[model samples]
Target: MSCDAIGSRLTARDIGWGPNAAHTLIEKVSFSLDAGDRLAIVGPNGAGKTTLLRCLYRGLVPTTGSVYVDDEDIHALPARKVAQKIGVVLQEMPADFPFTVKDVVLMGRIPWRVGLAGWTDADRQQADHALEHLNLQHLSSRTFSTLSGGEKQRVLIARALAQQPQIIILDEPTNHLDIRHQLEIVDLLSSLKLTVIATLHDINLAADFATKAALMQDGRMSAFGPARTVFTEDRLSGTFGVKVRKRPEVTSGFTFSLAAS
Candidate 1:
């Protein structure tokens, strides 16, 4: 029910990345959060939310600045070390190689494996635990490629959990889910003990899930702070081109009306 406070901190210092100044996707964005904070990065499409996320997870090295984990530059760490600390669930992925759902979940154990040894019993147990946690045990024997989008998303999250990572970075984690599953995912994330950084298109869900938020606009961080503060009506309306209202009496607590042409 509560985060572990593993004692490590994730900080982004003046991070910027792009091929050149003419095309910098993310620019000079900076923020810091402790191990348990759920920081939702929200912005309009092309606002560079994904780009900033990649930089944070070291999926792409920033052209400027650096990301640090407890004073150690993330880029300077070994890939295995990074993998050990950070688990990633990207947007819906295609699997062509014909692996079972269990096989895919077991892949998370690769970080803990040595040079060429096969999966250990501990690996299978961890994978089983993750599968049960995500309620994917029924899909374990199914071919990963044959599953539905929502099922695949849950399997991917199970894989991330199998990693037993300190930080989990997800890009559009709820893309393929329905309303029930979306709420389940949100609740599951809110209950996690690790740090979470994710991009969300649904403003209300983001507000409900995040303890802190970073609002991006045109490759820059327009606002960063507590979720309620960063997701003010003005910020959401101006950034999303909609009239947004806070309705604290409701579950998600926000409502939106589109802008008139």
Candidate 2:
């Protein structure tokens, strides 16, 4: 699938969110994403990565500025319409819903439904394809709450894929998983043709998988650009408050390690 066919150009302009003038979780964050760009938002805890993502996905309305999808203001669009264009896999999971894995995945089709009726055959096919894509086909009939953390994460990703959105936003998609699973999840994301924006804690993974990277600090965008340009030792050390150094590569890809204090 080409980006022109499945992706939406996403832009956030001067976005800020806070309850009052005295407090702002994120401010003056702006970036534009073209089709096929995989952008990673990287920051330490309390750096507003998740908050910014929430604003983009319409989970939280920005207190200032706007987010546009394909040149349309996202806030002005209907919630269902926004949901159709942007698929999100959040960091938190639901509190033990009784639905099976397939049932939960089928919920992705709710935005497309025209009436109060149950899912149609087309919805089932889409859900099934998503399940297979995420390697969750064998677990379709399993209870959602019974799955392990990695399984649960894949299920949520399957649900997002079932939505068939133009863009996908993931908040820490690799959280709570082992190293192998983390690599697997990131690898799967790299293979997708859709526009992807994610918050990644792993700097190495961001360097390898993200075409663009944004560094956030104290509610501000410190840097945003191509991953290679933004992931340098000076920038990484400054943003993270650690002495970082690029390790000598024994392999093809770049790697970094913290220098001793």
Residue 66 of model 1 has an lDDT of: 96
For model 1, name the residue pairs that clash.
Answer: none
TM-scores for every candidate against the unseen true structure: 0.93, 0.94
lDDT of 2 by residue, 139-210 (tens): 999999999888888898888888988899999999888998899899988888789999999998888889
Q: lDDT per residue, candidate 1, 20-127, as tens digits? A: 778899889999988788989999999999999888888899999999987889999998999888889988487564999999999999999999999999999989
lDDT of 1 at 152: 85
Candidate 2 — which pairs collide?
none
> Each model's C-alpha lDDT?
0.87, 0.89
- lDDT for residue 255 in candidate 1, whole number 0-100: 84
